[model samples]
Target: MNRVVTHELIHAFDHCRAHVDWFNNMKHLACSEIRAANLSGDCSFGNELSRFNFGLKQHHQQCVRDRALRSILAVRKVSREEAKLAVDQVFESCFNDHEPFGRIPHNQNEARFAYRDFQNRDRYNANL
Candidate 1:
């Protein structure tokens, strides 16, 4: 397959995965149009994923923390939330004294601040 196709598919897949996971957990049925579009095409994949305000926003926000996932993801031309998720997985994997895939913030100090902030924010939002 062409690299561009791969890129598009990857983006599409990320959009689908993010929104699907988001809605599946939250049951945000109202977002069907945006979710379906995300699954089907790349038209709003980057922007929507970056600005998506549905099911998984807190998770995405937690993962991104204070860091600009938009910029990081733009470098790879991937969705912002996708980058945040990558960072989330990093936290899940690197966190000590917790469940695997559990979103605990830890690691390199300077950079970890972002992860920590994200973790705290998610916790705060969840409680609200």
Candidate 2:
């Protein structure tokens, strides 16, 4: 439940902050999907491991890409290869754009800390 909310919220946040052409732009959709998967704890270590997806190098990244590809396919009427291409095209930049969290929240504890940091970001920025 929480994970789903967080994932959709990331999409909402992205939509609010960017001129995302959701219907026409595959890259925009792919970027948001990558960000959502990467930032929403959807690809957290525990989640991945429970899904029997672990032990590989760069597993987190692979998880994000796989999840993002799935998400794009779910909402867009596109071929799997096209969705994957879009995800791959924007994976690096989108995966690295840790906006409100400022980092990837890999677990519940990390997510809590990231939320705290997000809540206090304005204070930190004001001091800068």
Candidate 3:
């Protein structure tokens, strides 16, 4: 779906802009994966239920964290402890940092192609 594509696109965009060594930088990789999983609707209740059943109604934050952790561990090939440390180190910062939805740019030239921004711009231009 569009969400998944946009999520990976953000990773691509970040790699392009930062020239990050994704293969080696476990922290950076984990951070981006967490952001993508959380922001890209991968952790939505409906999405989760579609993939696996959750008997109890857990908090959304827990669901998001679980989803993010799974994604982070999938790559970087790091031990669980290392991945957990990295995820914990960056979780607060990356999880809160979202584009379009949370438009407080970290810098002057934040990426403008996020889904929310595109939609907002489209709607605004439509009336003009």
Candidate 1 versus truth, CA RMSD in Å, comes to 15.8
lDDT of 2 by residue, 47-68 (tens): 8779887867898898889889
Worst 10-residue stretch by lDDT in candidate 1? 25-34
* Candidate 2 Cα errors over 4 Å, as ranges: 123-128
Clashing pairs in 3: none
User: How close is every model to the real structure, measured as TM-score?
Assistant: 0.21, 0.88, 0.68
Ranking by lDDT: 2, 3, 1
Q: Over the stretch 72-124, how does candidate 3's per-residue lDDT look in tens digits?
A: 77765767888778778888887877744454322224334454575776575
Error of 3 at 62 (Å): 2.3
Error of 2 at 111 (Å): 2.3
Number of the predicted model whose lDDT against the real structure is largest: 2
Kindly give the number of clashing pairs for every candidate.
Answer: 0, 0, 0
Positional deviation of residue 28's Cα in model 3 after best superposition, in angstroms:
0.4
After superposition, which runs of candidate 1 have C-alpha atoms over 4 Å from their true positions? 1-64, 93-128
